[model samples]
Target: MAATPALEIAPEKVAHVIIKAREYGAKVGAWNASTEEGDADEDPSAILEDFASDPTLGEIAGFIDALNDDEQANLVALAWIGRGTFEPEEFDEAVDTARSEQGNSTASYLLGLPLLSDYLEEGLEKLGFSANDVESDVL
Candidate 1:
């Protein structure tokens, strides 16, 4: 394995983002018309419903938006690495690209990715950080 490069973004911060991203991704569209008749009190699965008012989305976006420019760029680079757009050894290049290509809000860009949680987790692992360990600590 290659030596893991140091990260401008902290692993714990990434872990928190991963946890929130998973929560947001796990949400399903609102109950179908047929299932809408089901009693909400009895349907434990209601928690999975993606209501427009769900706070998870906003929380994650806000969190990402709060990161410094370098951290945000590194976060995007990490995702690119995990998504196989770049190898772990190409970390610097990925970061450079992320920095250069950033047009919209980092939060918006990252939140748009359907596999954000998985990518971040894989990125952390590729960088030789234990996602589980960091997540455990955060939890």
Candidate 2:
């Protein structure tokens, strides 16, 4: 069966979602960088287990250490929306924009948002990395 059309998310919500995305990414990097031995694309989960139990955690720290101010902001917004941290109506607007622009619903587009380290972590999770741990230290 064909999929039903998704409701649009708003600009305000989109903005917030982007921030979360950045945060998630940054946290993952941070976790990885904290380790004595850095993780790579291949089998990074093993090292993550030793470092923070959550593989994506490294990317958060990594983001803070590596990304510039603007890039950081963008990623955070991605996570915010991904996790539903936006006003209902606003989120709808953004989703609508995303659908028209990216040919997919806002949530899906957020997941696939370019330049998001968190998005990369999502892929890692698919590879068996855990993205459950939340870093209270992260702002």
The TM-score measured for candidate 2 stands at 0.27
For residues 18-125, write the lDDT of model 1, one tens digit per residue. 999999999888886445443458888888888767789999999999999999999999999889999999999999999999999999999999999999999988
lDDT of 2: 0.39
For model 1 the local lDDT of residue 104 reads 95
Error of 2 at 111 (Å): 17
Task: List per-prediction Cα lDDT, in the order shown.
Answer: 0.91, 0.39
Top TM-score model: 1
Worst 10 residues of 2 by lDDT: 1-10
Error of 2 at 106 (Å): 23
Best by lDDT: 1
- Tens-digit lDDT track for model 2 on 1-139? 2332232222233333335555444443334455555455665553323344554434434434354433334333334444445332343343444334444232344445445545433422332323442222222
